[model samples]
Target: MSKRARLLAALVVVMTVFVGAPADADRGISVPAFYTPPSSLPSENGALIRSEPLPLALSLPGLDGPLPGRATRIMYKSTDNNGRPVAVTGAYLEPTAAWKGPGKRPLVVLAPGTMGQGDHCSTSLALQRGLILGIGVTQSTVSIGYEVLAAYRLLAKGIAVVQTDYVGLGTTDRLHTYVDRVDEGHAVLDAARAARALTGTTSDVGLYGYSQGGGATSSAAELQASYAPDVPLKATYSGAPPADLLDTTTAIDGTELVGAIGWAVNGFVQSDPSLKPLLDKYLSDAGRAALKDLSTMCVGDAIFAYANKKTSSWTTTGQSIADVLRSEPVARAYIDGQRIGTTKPAGIVRVATGVNDNLVPHPQARTMAANWCGLGGDVVYVPVDNVKTPSPLLNHFGPLLSDQGTAVDWLAARLAGTPATSNCGALPGQ
Candidate 1:
């Protein structure tokens, strides 16, 4: 790692020490039995497997629970892209705040941003333990439950939130399918089903997410028509969605999250065995080691270990990930399969992007909106042009924090039977 990277890591370590939070007791070592998938799953997609009440790690006065709502750790049946029944784990948060909307209530699957590949890094786990400070012999896996901020906002509005841990993040059976279009979309749609099973609430649904979550929700919106036709998907709030992974890969290179390239590689290869040639032919031994390390790391450990590193060092030929994609037609085609916006998203959709976000990039997200507009879909384009951060990761995050309120509000209105207008009609390049 570079000197600057080491310094960043050290500074964070020092911050954790000063904060004085106790180290995670057993989570640092083994995967709990609760995370284990059933020996045989039910054939129906979105079938409820089991659930148990989960305690939120964060607490405050006047709140009935540690959170603004009640949380449950749930495992549900969901199919992967390859047509196999997979046990997907997630959390269902029922708000204490009463629903003042026009209908019974609405449930929104809050697809989380990139939470990393470890069971310890799951959003469901994070919700229970607000901040996990994992102190391993080699390194610590750290992830603050930042998704709670958005979940709290929705809960305050009396909307129920079901957060998916994706296909494998918490579940020990498989590696987290980082952003496989089919895997992510199916996990999210099934989370809605899991929520309904837990509460038996016949409520309309909305999808909300940012960054990786954005990609998942957007994918779910498009897939809902066929995949989960029973789901009453009312609207989707997609923030900084990586509609095109090729562009996203190029954009993420050399940033703090450059290690994410490895996450994607590990996921793609695991999901499609045909891509295993990539491991032997292209990746160097050091690259393989990095993938092993990242396989179980959370975002904090990832940034600490691989900050600002480039992918050139990972390849035998010293070629960047961009180069590998350019050189290998099969690899490029496989990644292209992860791209969103191929079909117009069903129902009202709000697509927001940071104009200066080079991390996920701004153009691909805009392209999704344009594609929806061309298809005569109800699309509202919200460009968060107000802020720019010098740091690439922060630049991508800026829009999410700034636009989350409006995004939630838009979803709330749609859930309350408001007719969503299409700004695509007046927008340029539509």
Candidate 2:
């Protein structure tokens, strides 16, 4: 067994002792009506479709009530990559702590790091229950309690948070557009707009995310100017954004999260069906089955199913997923279109990455920061200098745990109207 699989085994043992059924356990165990989209959506982007008070399980005792805040599960209208209106699901938290900052409360849209492609794996569900178990015969799920800490930290600082489920993670209308830049960006921006519509107040907005969420926020930062100019961005913190698809796929292959390559293929084809035939031509029978299997899997299931595997095993040509992309111009063009740093992002931004993040590759992330810097954009590029770990996940997750507190503080400072700093002068050395 791989070190990654062994670590997952250890986690399962630890989590099994603490895991309990959630209060509002997704009706996926039965039937989920809340996840079902309506026949028609609100015409305007960011328009609120529906909402209900959502109870949170991780609240703390306070003089008034809970230390963090109240939450609402919301469905809101947003445009997909196809230019059609889609109803995206997410959670909106009204912070209980007093905002000592300079504005009338700020909203930070927390794009969750890769939560699964399944409806039950939504991060909103994690916020409600503090843990999630993906019940399947072959699929075991990791507890998502860790990721919720970032949201709680923001809420404690009197910062409102909106955790987007992206295009389809929770909503059952379509397959989750995993890593699709436009869909993820629209989901992030519209989430902020939806929160303001719910509160009926003007609030400064920020974007915070890591891993897949990092890619989403970075894309959102770039897309905000032309896509949703009405939604002003105060700050953006994108940790380990997967800017280059070929590099990212190459890094993940033969690792714990090898199944992620399947996710990228599934998502890219969904966004532009024009590539479907080409994908069909290249995938082996094993590849087809893997895609079908991974479409419904969480991190644990994926790790268990495809750890230490390679995309070459899934292809008819035996070419790795990266080579497959290089083999076709249409496919290569699609991948290039997903690349970040093409245009200047709208707001003050901070891009941080683990120097040894084998999962997302550190160079592509640093390249994004440098690209923004060359555009004369205000950017803070942080290299989470950590020693290399043999475990890919540790190499990736360590920096997230260590640097997130500082990243959150930096964003909070931006919201408080602090004069932003740029390391562009020193970027050339990197």
Q: What stretches of model 2 exceed 4 Å from their correct place?
A: 1-31, 134-145
Query: 348-393, model 1: which lDDT tens digit per residue?
Result: 8999998899999999999988988897778999888856767899
lDDT scores of the candidates, listed in order? 0.84, 0.83
**Alpha carbon deviation, residue 374, candidate 1 (Å):** 1.3
Candidate 2 lDDT over residue span 256-354, tens digit each: 888888888888888899999987899999999988888867666688778999899889989998998987999999998889888898888899999
TM per candidate: 0.92, 0.92
Specify the poorest-scoring 10-residue window by lDDT in model 1. Answer: 12-21
**Candidate 2 TM-score to native:** 0.92
Steric clash pairs (candidate 1): none
Give lDDT for model 1: 0.84
Enumerate residue pairs that collide in model 2. none
